[model samples]
Target: MKHEKRWAIVSLASIPLVMTLGNSMLIPVLPTIEKKLNISSFQVSMIITLYSIVAIILIPIAGYLSDRIGRKKVIIPSLLIAGMGGIVSGWAAWKMDNPYILILIGRVLQGVGAAGAAPVVMPLVGDMFKSEKEVSKELGVIETSNTFGKVLSPILGSLLAGLVWFLPFFAIPIFCAISILLMLFLVKSPKMKKPVPFKKFFKTIKKIFKKNAKWLIAIFIIGCILMFVLFGVLFYLSTMLEDEHKIEGVKKGLILAIPLASLCIASFVTGKKIEENKVLMKWLTFIGILLSAGSVFAISFTENIYFLISIFFICGMGIGVALPCLDALITEGIEKEERGTITSIYSSMRFIGVASGPPLFVLLMKASHQVMYYTVTGICILAAIIALVGIKPKEIK
Candidate 1:
C-alpha cells in the first residue's frame, strides 16, 4: 500500500478498534462493577446488553443517512456522540452512589454512536479502493485489528480496573478521541454524486433485496451465528478460568487471548488469500465453519483446560477465516450506492449476536458439557449449510 492508502486504512481501522475497546474491555471489569455498585449479575450485564440492543435498532438508520449525506458527515458526529457517552458513563461511575442506571444510559448512547461509526467502515473501505485484492487485504487488516482488540480487551480491562474500578469507563472517550483525530486528518472518503432521492431510497433497497435476498439473508444469519458462538464460548472460558481454575486478572486474560490470537492470525491470512476468488471464499468459509463445528465437538469430550485451549484455538481459526470471507462476499456482491445500508444491516445482525451471546451462554451452561458443545456445534453446522446452499461462487462477482 502507498502512504495515502495506508493512512486511510489506519484511520478507518481505528473506529472498530476503539469501539471494541470500549465494549469488550468492560467484560473483565463487570464483576468489579457489580461489587462496587452492589448490583446483581444480571444488572451488570445490562450495562453491556443495552449497548448492543440500542445499536441494533439504529445502525440501519445511520447507514441510510450515510448514503444520503456522506460517510464522514455521519461518522465524525457519531464518534463524538460515542465519546460523550463514555464521559457520561465515566462521570456516573465516578460521582454517583449508585451509578447503575446512569451507566446503562451512557452505554445506550454509546450504542447509538456505534451504529453510525464502525458499521459504516465496510462500505467506506469498499468505496476507498478500486482493486478487489486491495479491498480484501485492507479488510483483512481491519478484521485483524478487531480481533486484536479482543485479545487485548481482557488484559487491559483487568489492568485498568485494578487501579480504579471506573478507569475503563473513562478510557473509552480517550480511545475515541484518538480515532476521531486520525479519521478527521487522514481519511478521505469518495465524493458522493447525486444520491438516490429519499422518496425512492427505500424502494431501491426493497428492489435490491428482491433481487439478492437469498445470499444476503444467508450472510446475515451466518454472521450472527459466528458471533453468537464466539462471544458465548469466550464468556464461558472467562468464567471458567476465573471461577473454576482459580485464575484472575492478567493471567486469565493472557490465557483467554490464546484462542483470539489464533483468530486474528487466521483472519489476516484468509483475507489475503481469499481475494476475489468467489469459489475459494465460499468454500473457505464453508470449511471454516465445519472445522469450527468439529472443534466444538472435540471440546465436548475434554474437561482439561490445556486440551480445551488447544481445541478453542482451532475453533478461533475457523471463525477467523469465515468472518472476512462473509464480509468480502457481502461487500463485493453489493452495489456501492447501497453498500452502507446493506452492510449496516449486516453489522446490526452482528451486534445482535454479541448481545444475545452472553445471556444465551449463561442459559446453556446449566446443561452438561455434552449439551453445551452439541448446541454450539449445531449452530456452526447450520452456518456451514447456509454457506453451502445459499452462497454461490457465481454470486460473488
Candidate 2:
C-alpha cells in the first residue's frame, strides 16, 4: 500500500475502534451500573441492546445516504452526534438522582450515530482500494481494530469505572473526537459517479440481491449469529466473574480480555493470510464457526473457571478467523455503487445479533447453564452449515 492509503486506513480504522469501545467498553461496567442504580440484570443489559436496536433501524438509511453523498460526509457528522450522546449519558449519570431512563435515551442517540459511522467503514475501504487483495487485507485490518477495541474495552472500562462509575460514558466523546480529527485530516473520500435516482437505485439493489441472494443472505445470517454468540458469551462471563468467582475491577477485566485477545490476534493473522481467495474465505468461515460450536458444546460439560476461560479463548479464535472472511466476501462481491447499501444491510443484521444477545442470554441462563451453552452451540452449528452450503465461491463474482 502507498503511504497515503496507509494513512487513510489508519483514519478509517479509528471509526470501528472508537465505535466498538463506545459500546463494548460498557459490557464490563454493566455490573457496576446495575449495583449503582439498583437495577436488575435485564435492565442493565438494555444499555447495550438499546444502542444496537436504534442502530439496526437507521444503518440502511445511513448506507444509502453514504452511497448517494460521500462516506466522510456521513461519518464526521455521525461522530459529532455520538459524542453528544456520550455527554448526555455522562451528565445524567453524574448528576441525576434517577439517571436510568436518561442514560438509555443517550444510548439511543449514540446508536443513531453509530448507524452512520462504523458500518460505513467496510464500503469506504472497498471504495478506497481497487485490488481485491488490498480490499481483503484492509478489511482484515478494520476487523482487527474492532476486535482490538474489544480486547481493550474490558481493561480500560474497568480502570475508568474504578475511578468513577460513570467515567466510561465520558470517555466516549474523547474517543469519537480523536477519530473525527483523524478522518478530517487524513482520509480522502473517493470520487463517486453522478447520483442515481431513488427508483433506479432501488431497482439496481433489488437486481443485485436477486442475482446473489443465497450467499448474500447466508453471510448476513452468519454475521448476526457470530455477534449474537460473542456478546452473549461476554455478558455471561462478566457476570460469572463478578458474582460467582468474587472477581471484580481490573482483575476481572484482565480475565475478560484473555479470550478477546485471542480473537484480535486471530483476526490480524487471518486478514493477512486470506488475500482475495473466495474459496479460502468460505472454508475458513465454515471451519471457524465449527470450532466455535465445538468449544461452546464443551462448555456444557465443565464448570471450572480455568476450563471455561480456555474454552472461550478457543471460541474467540473461531469467531476471529471467520469475521474478516465474511467481510471480504461481501465487500469483494459487491459493485462499488451499491457496496455501501449491501454492507450496511449486513451490518444491521450484525447489530440485530448485538441487540438480542445479552437479554436473550439472560433468559437462557435462567433456564439452565446447559441450556444456554447448548442453545448457542446449536446456533453455531446452523451458521456453519449455512456457510458450507450457501456460499459458493465460484458464484461470488
> TM-score: which candidate is best?
2
Estimated TM-score for each candidate: 0.97, 0.99
- Writing each residue's lDDT as its tens digit, candidate 2 over 1-397 gives 4999999999899999999999999999999999999999999999999999999999999999999999999999999999999999999999999999999999999999999999999999999989999999999999999999999999999999999999999999999999999999999898998999999999999999999999999999999999999999999999999989989999989999999999999999999999989999999999999999999999888778999899999999999999999999999999999999999999999999999999999999999999999999999999999999999999898
Candidate 1 lDDT over residue span 122-207, tens digit each: 99999988888888888888888888888888888888888888989889899999989998899988898689787688888998
> What overall lDDT goes with each candidate model?
0.87, 0.96
Off by over 4 Å in 1: none
**Candidate 1: pairs in clash:** none
lDDT of 1: 0.87
Backbone clash pairs in model 1 (N, Cα, C under 3 Å; residues 3+ apart or in different chains), count: 0
